[model samples]
Structure formats: C-alpha cells, structure tokens
Target: MDISIREGILTPDTFAGLRAACGMPELETALVGRAIESSLFTLSAVNGSRTVGMVRVVGDGAFVFLIYDLLVVPLWRRRGIGSRLVEEAVSRAKLFVPPGRAVVVSLFSAEGREGFYSRLGFTELPAAGLGAGMQCFYL
Candidate 1:
C-alpha cells in the first residue's frame, strides 16, 4: 500500500472521520476547521482519496510546540504512518527554533502509548530533571 503525506490539506470532515476511526469523540465542525486553520502545521496521510491519518502542531511558533491530535485509522495502525506524521511535525518544530536558542517540542501521549513517542526520543516529564507536566479540562 502507498501512503502519501501532505501538509495543510485537511478538511473538517476528514479530520472528524479520522478522529472517529480512532475512537475519539466527534468534534464540532467549526471548531475543527478553526483549529486546523490556526495550527502551526497540519499533516495528513492519504490513501488515494481517503484520509487515513493526521497530526497537528500547535504552539506560539517559537518557544513551545505541542503535538496534538495524532491519529491513524485503525486499519492503518502498526504501519508507521503515525510515526511518520510525528516525525514531520517534529521536523517543522525544529525549524521554528532560532540559532543559539532552544525550543520545546512536547505532547501529551495518550495512555499506554508512551512507547510510541519515546521511541522517537520523547521523554516522560518530571523524570529527567524536568517538572511534572499537568493539565486541567473543564467538563
């Protein structure tokens, strides 16, 4: 099978479908479109005309980059598509850093998926001289 990765070509429908295929709840179409348009970068993997995977980078475009919504359809998991998406996002993040300075590229890994990101060099926070990462969601 051939997979092509394209940047900044995701539609809300495709994004929602990919999210659903990955067992995530549906998001509002307007919100998804707004998020995509506002993201630092967005990448989608296409198998012909269907979107099989997607990943996005969100941040202030210099100091911090957070990998968000990394998802690959169930049928495409275990095939490295997700890894490739992350690699592309990381590459973009590096470009945002200015010379003689550093930028943080981080993500909140889905539970039980630490190995996936760790293999790509992401470390668990608060474990290597860093503070614990925290978040709060309003329900």
Candidate 2:
C-alpha cells in the first residue's frame, strides 16, 4: 500500500473528517476545529484521497513538544499507518531540536494505551515520588 503523510492545512472540512476518524465518543468537533486552526503542526495520512489518520503537534516549537490527537480510523488500525505518522513527526522534531539543549517530548497515554506508545519508543518517566508534582488544570 502506498501511504503518503503530509503536512495538511487544517480547515473546517478537513477537521471534521479527521475528528470523525478519531472514533472517540466524547470528542467535540468545535474544540477540534479550534485546535486544528491554532495548533503548530497538523499531519494527515492519505491513502489516495481518503485521510485515514491524523495527529496534531502542539508545543513551543523549541524545547517542549507535545503530541496530541493521534487518531487512526478503525479500518486503518494495525496497518502501520499510525506508526508512520508518529515516526514522521518525530523526525521533523529532531531536525529542530538543538544539540544538547533542554528538549522534552511528552505525551499522555490513557490506560492500556501505554503498549502502543511503548512500541513507538516511548516509556514512562520514573516516578521517584519527589518533585514539584505533575499538575494539570481541567474544568
């Protein structure tokens, strides 16, 4: 199968289609639209004219990079499309990450999702039970 991964400009139509591919019951199209328009990097995996998968990268574009919204349609799962998408994104980041600078690439994986990320070369940062603490503000 010929798969093309490209940096796609996010629009209302593209965003809606990508959101649908996510297969998440609770995802909001409005928020996704807002994010796609505002995020730093958005990627689309195209098999012919169909967008099979999508992922969003949000970060300072310097030191801290966060991977978000890595979604692959059910039909495309286990087909290596998602892995290629992640690989392409990581490759792009490597180009910009300064040598020896304090660069951090982070992602949050839900329970049972760790294995997926692990297969992609991600591992949990050790929990030393010491630090400023992991903090998140959600409404």
Candidate 3:
C-alpha cells in the first residue's frame, strides 16, 4: 500500500473518523479541533486521500513531548504505517529544541501494546528510577 505521512494536515473530522474506525469512543469534534490546534505537532498517514492513521504530539517543546492519539485503521495495522508515524513524529519532536538539549517523549500505549512501544525504544515506566505513569481524568 502506498502511504504518505503528511505533517500538520489533520482535520477534526478526520480525527473523529479514525477514532471510530479504531473502536475508540466518540469525541466531540469541537473539542477535538481545540486539541488539535493546541498540539505542538500532528501527522496524518494518508493512502490516496484517505487518512488511515494519525498522531498528535503535545507538550512544552523543551521539556516534554506526549505522543497522543496514535492510531491506524484496522485495515492498515501491522503494515509498518503506525511505526513510521511514530518514528517520524519523534524525529520531529527532537528538532523542537536546540542541540544538546534533551526532551522526554511519552505516550500512554493502548492495552497490550506495551511491547510495541518498547521495541520502538520506549522504556517501560517504573524502570531505572522512573516511577509508573499516572493520570487523573475529570468528570
């Protein structure tokens, strides 16, 4: 399959569609648009005008980068499209800061997908002095 990774081209509707295709719960498109606008970077994986996958990176450019909403439609999974999206996003994240500065790239992987991120050079939390990741969702 011919897939092209486009930078900063994600639309809220496209994002909602991808989420639905991946079996994730629906989100309000207005909220999604706001989130997309706030992202430091966004990438869309397109196969002939259809968005098959996408990722959003958010955080202060110098200190942290969160890889959010990494998704590839079911039909495109395991074909390296997801991996390429992540690698490319991280590569761009690294450039956000000046030389010799380090930034933490973090992501909350989907259930059972820890090994995927691990193989991509992400260390499991609570290892090597890092604590397990935590989160708090609002009502």
Candidate 4:
C-alpha cells in the first residue's frame, strides 16, 4: 500500500522476478541488465524493499520514446501502481523535449490491456491517422 516510485534502480533479478510474477517469459540476466541500463529512463514501484512494478522508456530522446516493459506483480495490480508508473514515465519523457516542441510516448500494450492504457491517455495505433504499430521478435 505504501509504494514509492524510484528511477533506474532495478537489478536484473528484480526485473526478472516481476516478470515471472506477472507470467511473462524470463530473459537472461545479462541481457536484462543491459536493457535496464540502456533504458532512456526507468521507473520502478517499490513497496518497502520489494519491487512491485516497473516501466522503461526507450528510443531517441528527440523523436520517440517507447514505454517498454511495464509490469506490475499480480498482487499489486489495479491498485494504481501501474498507472503511477506509466504517468511518471510519461512525465519523464516530456522532460526530454524542448519548449514548444513535442515528442511521442509509445507503448505496445499487452492484449486485453489496451483499455488500461487508453484510460491513461494513450490512443490505439491506426487511430489519429497513424498506421498501426508493428513488431517482430527473435528468440
């Protein structure tokens, strides 16, 4: 219930733990470390010493910012922790742009989670005259 949002302090283990807790596939710790460190910005939700959720921002600071790897442990879902992580991540992304300029903050929402993000001000792709976003994965 007492959650604090912190910046860039996630260990690979903590990240992988949250992923597993949320039923996402695990990644190699080395790769997870690289991803965490290379993130343009990251916010983690900590309740006491445990990491309950996280969101990472990736992409060039000028043109695009992708809200990647947003995960909240099942125990903490629907308690506003995810929303706070996203709101904080987007707030940080806005800081990267200059006055009178704009930048995009994008994310690939999990299936059935679109409504959660839409309520937080994200429009689905292919709306607003933009083509639908696409992705491919390599194992």
Candidate 5:
C-alpha cells in the first residue's frame, strides 16, 4: 500500500474515526474541529483517500512542543506509519525554533508503548537525574 503522509488536511470525522480505531473514546465533533485548527502541526497518513493514521503537535511554537493523539488503524499498526507520522511531526516542530536555540519535543507514550518512542530517540523521564514527568488532566 502506498501510504502518503500529508499535513493539515484532517477533518473532524476522519480524526474521530482514527481515534476510535485505536481504541480511544469518542470525542465531540466540534471539539475535534477546534483542536485540529489550533494544533501547531497535524499529519495524516492516507492510503488513497482513507485516513489510516494521524499525529498532532501542540506547543508554544518556540521553546516547547508536545506530540499528542498519534494513532494508526489496527490493521496498519506494524507498518511503520506511526513512526513516520512522529518523525514528520518532530521535524516540523523543530522548524519553529531558530537555529542555535534549544527546543524540547516531548510526548506521553501510552502505557506499554514507551519502547516505540524510545526507538525513535525519546528518553523516558526520571533518568538522567530528571524527575518523573507529571500531568493533570481535566476530568
């Protein structure tokens, strides 16, 4: 299959479908639309016209970027689509910072998925003397 990764062409419906296929809870269509519009970068993996994978980056556009909502349809999982999406997203996020300046690109890997990101050069926190990463989610 020829999977083509494109930027900024994701629709709410496609986003929701990809989310569902990855076992995530359904989100409101309006919320998906707003999130897509606000994301710093968004990439969708397409096989012909179907969206089989996606990833989003959110950040301040200068110093910090957090990758979020990376998902690929189950049938497509072992084919390197997720890795490609992440590589592209990180590449674009780095462009937001000026040369010689440092930028942090981070993500919270889903449980049991840390190895996937690690292979792509992400280090888990609490190593290297840094504290464990923390988060507070809205209930």
Candidate 6:
C-alpha cells in the first residue's frame, strides 16, 4: 500500500472510521470537529484515497503538550503505523520545547498498551510528572 502522511483536520466521513480503527471510545463529533480545527499538529496516513492512520498533538504551544488520538486502521495496525505516528508526535514535541526546563508529554493509554508505550521509550513516572497531579474526577 502507498501511504502518505498529510497534515490537516480529520474529515467528517473519516472520523468514525478512524476512531473505530484505533479502538478509541466514541466521542461527540462536534467536539472532535472543533478540536480538529484548533489542533496545532496532526498527521494522517493515507493509502490511495483512504485514511488508514492518524495522530494528533494538542497543547498550549509552549508549556504543555499532550499526545492524543493515535489510531491506525485495524487492517493497518501491525505494520508499524502506530509507532510512526508516535515518532511524528515526538518530533513535533521537539519543535515546541526549548533548552530550559523540560517538555512534558503525556497520554492515557488503553489497558494492555502501557507495555507497548514502555517499549517505545515511555516509562512510568515515579515523580515530577504524572505523579504530581491529583484527579478530581474521571470519566
């Protein structure tokens, strides 16, 4: 398959397809649609005319960067697309942070995927990051 990565908002038709492909829970389209327009960085992998994979990075453009919505279609899952999406996000993160304190990149992965991220060089934070926050509510 010929896969090309493009930068743009996720189209409405591809929204459900992409969400299901990535195994993400359903979200309101309007909310997601609004985000697509405001996203600072987004990469989509397309095969011919089909969107096969995608990932987005949403943040304040300076202090905080969060990785979100990474999903490769089920048919394309094991072909290193997921990791490529992550690599792209990391590369974008580099563009956001300068040489001073530290850039914090965080995400909440699904149940069995923590090991997958650890394999990708993400580790459990003992402190100073994930450990520094207190949650009021979770959905």
Give per-model CA RMSD: 1.4, 2.9, 0.9, 1.3, 1.3, 2.8
Query: lDDT tens digits, residues 1-139, model 1?
Result: 8999999899898899888888889888999999999999999999998889999999999777999999999999899999999998988788888765766899998899998899998998779678988999998
**TM-scores for every predicted model:** 0.93, 0.80, 0.96, 0.94, 0.94, 0.81
Better-scoring candidate (TM-score), 2 or 4: 4
**TM-score, prediction 1:** 0.93
* Model 4 accuracy (lDDT, Cα): 0.91
Ten residues in a row with the worst lDDT in model 1? 95-104
lDDT of 5 by residue, 3-84 (tens): 9999999889999988888888999889999999999989999999889999999888987799999999999989999999
**Could you tell me how far off, in angstroms, the CA of residue 98 lies in candidate 4 after the best superposition?**
1.1
> Which candidate number would show the highest TM-score if scored against the true structure?
3
Question: In candidate 3, what are the lDDT values of residues 1-100, reduced to their tens digit?
Answer: 8999999999999999999999999998789999999999899999997999999999988888999999999999999999999999989998998877
Question: Which portions of model 4 miss their true places by more than 4 Å?
Answer: none
lDDT digits (tens) for residues 18-131 of candidate 4: 989998898998999999888898899999988999999998888989999999999899899999999999888889999767768899988999999999999998897799
Regions of model 1 farther than 4 Å from truth: 99-101
State the local distance difference test value for candidate 5. Answer: 0.91
Query: Where is model 5 more than 4 Å wrong at Cα?
Result: none
Question: Which pairs clash (backbone N, Cα, C closer than 3 Å) in model 2?
Answer: none
lDDT (C-alpha) at residue 42 in model 4: 84
Lowest lDDT 10-residue stretch of candidate 4: 98-107
* Residue 47 displacement in candidate 1 (angstroms): 1.6
